[model samples]
Target: MMRYSWLLSTVAAALLGSPATADEFGDPEAGAKVYSQCKGCHQVGAGATHRIGPHLNGLFGRPAAGLEDFKYSKSFQRAGASGLEWHAETLDAFLENPRSYASGTRMSYRGLKDETDRKNVIAYLRTFSDDPANIPEADPTATPTDHDIDPVILAIQGDPEYGEYLSSECTTCHQASGGDDGIPSIVYWPEDEFVVAMHAYKNKQRKHPVMQMIAGRLNEEEIAALAAYFKNLDN
Candidate 1:
């Protein structure tokens, strides 16, 4: 089944000419500009080598912490041990929030909050990998439908004190100190993004049974409070 799927994907890519040309994947030219933020830590293209971070050449299809010479954080090592592989979709998730995806990752960049930036950067990085033409163009796990949150709900001013009181249930899984064993660390997230994520769960636009149930119980103000609390938890 795996071989058959691979063959089908390859054929589809051939039909599409090159995955790079697909706008859904992103514009490499634009990505070049976005990639300036990453150049300091990573090197790519010809003659690239490990620096603060490993050279990103041939990153796609490589397992997490794949470089034998580079020392990776214990969190990344664990992710690799648990069979993590780099691909467009996985990269998108990680780039959206690095610490959340791999709790103890040494990469200090907060993350690209803009979806387009993440896509474009991934597209740019794809150029350094072998067989960029065959790489997938879209994230299959992305939310299938847009969940339009009400403006009023988004604008609500939350009480962080109340959020702290209500966060006991949340802290059970998500550590208060920003440590993520398996569950993602919620500390220090921007309030708006946190609110949006909880709403996504509440609306069932994002999948996760436990999250959905918790979000379902929270009113708009309560969600905002939680967002407010988490955003400043690290502070």
Candidate 2:
């Protein structure tokens, strides 16, 4: 049998319908303070070892449950196998709720709900790694300004009912429960903003190839509809 838990996490974002973070993170200094809450279970900075949690050195882009010294929950290891990379957005969602991100994970502390604390903690952790390349240079939340968006094309509002019908394909990766098996949840988003994001994917403004492919097939109306459908979902 596979060493994986078959249990499913909730099909909603960890913050229970809060908007996804598409903005800049908080100060690392502030995060270091917020992380005091985490010190009981985790350790960071120089000579940090495996405490209640694994040392998080060079965590960004590192695969989940990557440490050999610390035994991770089978659920976490399986999640790693499923391609969960610890990028900024991924970290953001997971920090919002660990158990929701990976059901059956052994982590016991409640997730950090403050977006600023989450960003700050991730930023503070970014300082632990020796390699600067492991850290992101610019804020991941900032939308690219290079491309001009079509206001006329975007003017159309989507039909949530039709979008709900079209959303079957989207839920394949985005799991309706907002479970983070390395994918971001679109649940509880602003409809228009969600359309703008999908259009970014369609225009190759966003970098992910899979999203580009998925968004490429959607017309402006379909994108709007799906956005509306998800926007109306209960958190």
Candidate 3:
């Protein structure tokens, strides 16, 4: 089972029966100090342009990956599509562990293991917005949940003939033959591998923008057909 170190204090406090008034509202001043830790990849305040990550200005209540200026990973966009709006809860869960919250995200930060730090940083970031209260409300104690996939869902077995029909779209970037360049060849791969790769793209666990878009358009049956075609092709 995955551990939630960030929630330990909150849980312990609850066990001790802390008063409701003792909510974990961090101080902006202290959060400003904590924000320094994030300065390497993010920026805020006036004229903040995107760095490794998007600027934090007006972040509260914004949809995930909604920034037009910053180039976000497709995985991040997928999280937004899955009803992930930025609120204190979402940010806390994310700051706890970006990769865990949004699987396969490119943000390499290890994570703020201390829950208070995450709260403080979020408090500081809230300052960037004009009216923080105007943003959406969320449960402060909420966290992201991991889901298990049932392999049986991909029930449609591979079909090579139909796979060839779908090759036109894939062949544009991937080599039809088993040679490779900047884009790798899809031909002659194991059917299972092909299916998993395609699903990864579809679910935005992989970062390629184009692949994510294409995968989103495909269904499990269509994907199985393509996988079958590629897996059966001569090397």
Candidate 4:
């Protein structure tokens, strides 16, 4: 089943290009504080024991819906089966909204209305786990510039090749029009709504054992790519 999932995801990826809005992102420090709300259910350290959700050690650059140990919702499993990667822009959108990102998603969180807060939370989160390195090293020869490179665009907008490679894991569930037993069908869902659903999942305000597990796996960029890919699919 996992092998077949890879096959479908490859085909789906061939149809789409890399995302264009990955670079616009914010602070990891703030993301850590925001994560306090999440500690109630998740563990972000490597080699950490699974709590209500699976451990989120290397969340950035991971495949969408790709935790082998966690029992995901039908929808998420389906997404993984289909082939998706959790890029930065995708994460931003998902954090902004979840229910709309993927219909039938079990998460119950509302979302992060403030963009700055969302970016800060994401920034802070990078420091906690292998989510992503939001802070880039300063080049000594160049001007000392702390210009905020939008993480969403940096992660998603550049090259489809990396994104394609990352998405290879989602096909495990999302490729088929009708999902396997536990996974849900996402081919028919609305694109914009899919973005919203991801956000609800990330905010932790949403409540669903499976969704919490899946959302906890993502950062910001991965979420954007996943949302974009699904939005472009034909039902």
Candidate 5:
């Protein structure tokens, strides 16, 4: 009995001192305010419906391109089909550059430059979770793959319905008609070339602070989705 008590006490202590759960990461309050930047297209909170972008409720631990009903870019679908799951690091990287993170994603907001800002945003997202404080720890064994597929090719591989959904954000600034000064008109960019440009922005090899800021947040697949959406634009 004494040995069992000691074992229980040791387990409790270890658990208490153990690192954060997989579901835990960073501050929702700060994330809430920062997320305001995303409100133009995305909707969160209770009973949130899909908007210009799809709903982000319970985004944590969900599939990369998992929103239902709302159309998603082909790139997003491919990523989701590839079995990518949302977590702290994934969200952090994505928040930094949506296009670079996914190759063809159509989200237009530049990523949060500061790491703390990303963490805060994660925190805000956590609030939507049933257990906001404890996020699951990342898989230590996971490593990024070296998929060298062309962005445009991947975009062509994406879904047009999803592309249309993502296009809503782009149309805000990248109108098919003459775009704003400095903002490139995305009416007819080749998918492969667009993917390359977005990657350059992500790596900081490409100039343009705005583009860099936005690109830094994306993944290869997102870049593909955004590229696909623009490639199919009527204008």
Candidate 6:
């Protein structure tokens, strides 16, 4: 009896662990209705063109400010330059709070506070993107790969005093006050995100010339130190 019960539990667990279907994310039809609020500033589907905001076609998998012809805000430009890409996770974060995500953006709408609305809107936008089956790696439906930081690197306890001294080079463009001008603010970022971003730049996964140069010179300890300092800057 115990063996049979264990077998049943294993089968149930396997079923529950199966990958979610695309529809599970949200309903495109419901999303279209929710997207009415965005109609004034944006457009999607065939014949969509730039309105007050950039057209939403091909939004998934696009980098922040990816369109060449359309001019983007300095904050968005900075975000793109820093290797920010538009995936499900990123879009969700941006939709939850637009201004908080990009402080210098021209987007005036407050944000979609409802999680259902955000998911639905994202689903609707996904319909306009390329089919995931064709471009499995780059498509929005594909799961994003997290940066594989070594355990030793992540475990390193940084010296903030050393980081402060090293930060002079960064402060020339990034504000210490967490202000976003033409450049995106680096202060008060979560240490893990900051470290991962820097490593991305260092590894040439992120494409900014200056960032690559700066990050390339820093060792693991230095990177951790910078991460620690910037994360606690507000404190």
C-alpha lDDT (0 to 100) for residue 173 of candidate 1: 95
Best by TM-score: 6
Q: Candidate 1 — which pairs collide?
A: none
- Which ten residues in a row are the worst by lDDT in model 5? 138-147
Candidate 6 lDDT tens digits, 1-235 = 2223334544564699954446446677888999999999999999999999999998876889999989999878987877777866567667766765665689998888777777788878888988562342434432222335677887888899999988888999988987765667888877876776777678764557898899999999999999889988963
Off by over 4 Å in 6: 1-23, 133-235
List candidate 1 segments past 4 Å from native. Answer: 1-21, 63-69, 73-85, 93-105, 110-118, 135-154, 159-162, 173-222, 230-235
Please report, in order, the local distance difference test score of every candidate based on alpha carbons.
Answer: 0.75, 0.67, 0.68, 0.52, 0.63, 0.75
RMSD of 5: 14.7
Clashing pairs for model 3 are: none
- Candidate 4's residue-wise lDDT over 156-203, tens digit each? 432234434545565566564555465555554453454445555665
Give lDDT tens digits, candidate 3, residues 61-106: 6878989877887667776665457766667767765655565478
Candidate 2, RMSD to the unseen true structure: 12.7
| Model 6 steric clash pairs | none
Which tens-of-lDDT digit does each residue in 1-235 have in candidate 1? 2223445665776688955234555767788899999999999999999999999998877888999999998868867775667766667767876765665789999988788887788888878877635434422222111234568998999999999988888999989988877777788877877787787668653446787799999999999999889888863
| Cα distance off (Å), candidate 6, residue 197 | 13
Off by over 4 Å in 5: 1-25, 135-235
Model 4, TM vs. native: 0.47
The candidate 1 region of ten consecutive residues with least summed lDDT is: 138-147
Give me the runs in candidate 2 sitting further than 4 Å from their true place.
1-23, 133-235
Clash pairs detected, candidate 2: 11-177, 11-178, 12-177, 12-178
